[model samples]
Target: MCGRYATTRSSGTLSQLFEAYDDTDGRHRPDWNVAPTKPVPVVRVDDAGERALSLARWGLLPPWATSPSAGARMINARSETVATSRAYAGPFARRRCLVPADGWYEWARTDGGKQPYFLTRADGDVLALAGIWSVWRGPDGPWLTCSVLTTAATGALAGVHERMPVLLPPTRWEPWLAPTGDPSALLGADEEWLAGLEIRPVGAAVGNVRNSGPELTARVPDVPAPRRAREDPRSTAEMPLF
Candidate 1:
C-alpha cells in the first residue's frame, strides 16, 4: 500500500511532463513527504480532449458518502476489484487519471524492526501511476478526490512487497486518462517496465508525518533488531527515515 510518497517537481516541470494546459493553482508547493488526505496533483482529460493538471484530495470520496472521512480509508483501490467495487465502479468506468510522483515509500519487516524503502524508476522519470477520481458532495460541500490503483508487485519490487501501484506507460497515458467502461486491461503489471525500477532502503524517520526533507528518503545502512510479527498502519503516517 502507498500510504505516503514524495513530489518535489516544480509546477512548470509537472505541467510540461504531463502536457497539462491549465495554469498552476499556486497553492501546491514542493513536498518531500506527502501524506494521505493532502491535496496532490493529478492529470486527467477534460471534455475538450486536453489534459488538465489539477489538485485533488488524495483520498477518494464516493458520491454516496456522507462525509469526506467516509473515503479517507480508501486512498488506494485494488486493481482486481476496482471494476466491481461500488465505491470505485463509476470512477473506474469514466474518471481515470494519472498520479505523478517522484517515488513511493514501502515498508519491509526485519528481525530488528520495520524498515522503509524508497522506490523509483531507474531513469529517474516521474511515475505516472494509474488512478481514478470522483466528485463527491456531502453536507459540507463538494470535493474532488482520487485513489491510486495497486497491482501485484513484479521484478525487484516483488521481494519487498506483494503489491505495488500500477504504472501506466507513456503510450497508454491517453487511453488511461480517458478510460471508458471497464479498465481491467490496464490493471496488470508490465514486466519490462517493472525491470526498469530500483529500490533503496531508507531511514525510519519517515514514520513520523511531521518529518519532511530530501534526507527523509536518503539511503541508510540496514541494522538488525527484534522482529515484530505485524506492523501498525499508523507507523507509516509520516515521512520514512532511511
Candidate 2:
C-alpha cells in the first residue's frame, strides 16, 4: 500500500509532462511526506472528456458514505478486488486518474529492524501511480477524493513488500483512462517494464511528517533504524497502509 510519497514538481512542469491543462486552485507546496486526507495533485479526464490537473483529497470517499471521516480508511484500493469492491467498483470503471509522485517509501525488514527505503525511477521521471477518484456531494459543495491502487509486488519490488502501487507507463496512460467496461488487460504482468526503477536507503527522518526538507530523503549508509521517528504514531511516511 502507498500511504506516503513525495511530489515536488511545479504546476507548469506537470502540465507540460502530462500534456494536460491545469485546473487546480493552486500549486501544492513540495512535500517530502504526504499523508492520507491531505489534498494532492492528480491528473484526470473531466466531464468534458479532457485531461485536467486538479487537487483531490488523498482518501477516497464513495458517494454512499455517510461522512467524510470515512475517507481516512479508504486511502488505498487493492487491485485484485478494485473492479468489484463496493466502494471502488464505480470509480474504477469510470473515474480513473493518475497520481503523480517523485517517489514512494517502503519499509524493508532487515536483521536490525524495519528500514525505510526510497524508490524512484533511475531516470528521475515522474511516476503515474494508477488511481481512481470520486466526487462526494454535500450541503457546502462537492468534495473531490481519490485512492491509490496497489497490486501484487513484482520483480525487484517484491523483495521489499508484498504489494506496491500500480504504475502506468507513458504509452499506456491514455488507454487506462478509457471508460471501458473492463481494463484488466492493462494490469497484466508489468514487472519487467519497471526495470528502470532504483531503490536505496534513506534517512529515518522521513518517518516524521513534521520533519521536512531534502534531509528527509537524503541517502544514508546502513545503520540501526532510529526509534523516535518510527515510533511516532502521527508519522505519515512510516505508517503501514496495509
Candidate 3:
C-alpha cells in the first residue's frame, strides 16, 4: 500500500541517473516524507526517444475516471493483475515509466503498535520503481499521473511485508520501458536484484501526513515491548479496559 515514501536526491543527480535532458525545475527539493497525491518526479521516454524527467501526481487516473480524485485510490497496481485491470490495463501495456526513490516506508505491526521501517538498497543507489503512467483530463485540465507496481515480497522483505514494489535493475530497465518481446518474462526477475537491500526502523513521525522532514527517518528506540495475551496484566484482570 505504499502510502508514503521518500525522495531526497537533487534533480541534477536524477537527470544524470535517468539520462534526462530537461533542466531542473528548481521547485523540487529533497523530501523525506512524500505522501499520497503529491507531485513526484518520474522518468519516461518521450516520443523523440529521449528520456525526460517530469513531475506527475503520484496516483494513476484512468482516462475513463469521472474526476481526478479517483486517482487517490489507485496509487499502486498489483503486478499480477495490472495487465487486465480496467484502471491500469491501457497504461500497463504502453505507458510504462520509472519512479525514482531513495527509499520506501513499510509498517510492521505487533501487539503494542505498528512501527515504520525504511527500506533501501545497500549500495545506496536510487531505486527505480517500475511504474505506469496515464493522462486524465477533467474540468480543470489534463494531468499526467503514475502508479507503482507491486509484487510478492521475497528475501528479508517478505518477513516485513507480503508485498513490495517491483524494482527494475539496470539490465532490465530498457526492456521494461519498451518491451520488444515477451513482457511477462520481464515481470518477475531473480531475487538477487534486491538481496543487498537493508531495512532500518524509523521514527513514527512519518505516520502523520502533515509531518515532513529528514528527521522522519531518524532511528528511534523500540519501546513498549509487545506482550502476549498470556503475559498481559489485563488478561488476568476481572474485566478488560475496552
Candidate 4:
C-alpha cells in the first residue's frame, strides 16, 4: 500500500502540469512525508466539466460515515474491488481524480524488519496516481476527502510489496478523470511504463512522518536483499502508454 509519498511542486506548477485551474487558494506547501488524514492536492473536473486543482483530505470518508475518524482506515481502496465496494462504488463511478506526486514510499518485508524504498520515474516526471474522491457533510459544512487506488504490484514492484498505486499515463489522464470512463480498463500497471521507474533504497528517516526534506528521498547504500532482487531500469527510458 502507498502509505507515504512526496509532493514538493508548487501549486502553480501543478496547475500548469495538469492543465487545470487552481482552486487550492494558495494553502498547499511542499511535503516530503505525506500521511493519511492530511490535506492533499487532487485534480478533478467540477460539475461544469472544467478541470480544477483542489485540496482534499488524504483519507476518503463515505457519505454514510458518522465522524471524520473513519477516513483514516480508508486511505487506500483496492482497485480490484473499487467499483463494487460499498464505500467506493459511488466515488469510483463519478468522482475520479488525479493525485499528483513526485514519488511514493513502500516498505519491503525483510528478515531484519521492513526496509523503505522510494519509487519514481527515472526521467523525474510527476506521477498522476489514480484516486477517487467523496464529499461528506457534517454540521460544520461539506468535507472533501479522497483515497488512492492500489492494484496488484507488477514487474519489479512486486519484489518490494504485493501492491502499488495505479499510475495513470498522460494518455489516460483525461479518461480517468471523466465521469463516464470505464475504470477497469485502466486499472492495471503497464510493464512498459513500469520499465521507466527506478526503485531506490532510502534511509529509515522516512518511517517517521515528522521527518521532512530531500534527505528522506536521498539514496542510501545498497544492501543485499533477503527477498527477491530489485531490478534496475536505469538504461530504459519511459515509453508511451499501451
Q: Which rank order by TM-score, best down to worst?
A: 4, 2, 1, 3
lDDT minimum window of 10 residues, candidate 1: 233-242
**Model 3, residue 181: displacement in angstroms?**
3.4
Which parts of model 1 are misplaced by more than 4 Å?
A: 222-242
C-alpha TM-scores of all predictions:
0.87, 0.89, 0.87, 0.92
Between candidates 2 and 4, the one scoring higher on lDDT is 4
Question: What's the distance in Å from true for residue 118, model 1?
Answer: 0.5
> How much does candidate 2 score in TM-score?
0.89
Task: Output the number of the TM-score-best candidate.
Answer: 4
Candidate 1 lDDT, 83-192, residue by residue in tens = 89999988889899999898899887777567787887767888888999998886667778999998866544655576888888887788787656447876776656
* Per-residue lDDT of candidate 3, residues 1-242 (tens digit): 57678899888889889888653467677889888788888888777777788788989998888877888899999999998898888888888888899889988765558867788876688898889998888788888899999997765565556688888887877877773555557778466767657666788789888888888876566533223323433323221111
**Considering only N, C-alpha and C atoms within 3 Å, which residue pairs clash in candidate 4?**
none
Candidate 4 worst ten-residue window by lDDT: 233-242
Q: Which is the better candidate, 1 or 3, if ranked by TM-score?
A: 1
Off by over 4 Å in 4: 230-242
Candidate lDDT (C-alpha), each:
0.78, 0.81, 0.77, 0.87
lDDT of model 4 at position 6: 95
In the order shown, what is each candidate's alpha-carbon RMSD?
5.5, 6.4, 7.5, 3.9
Sorted by lDDT (best first), the order is 4, 2, 1, 3
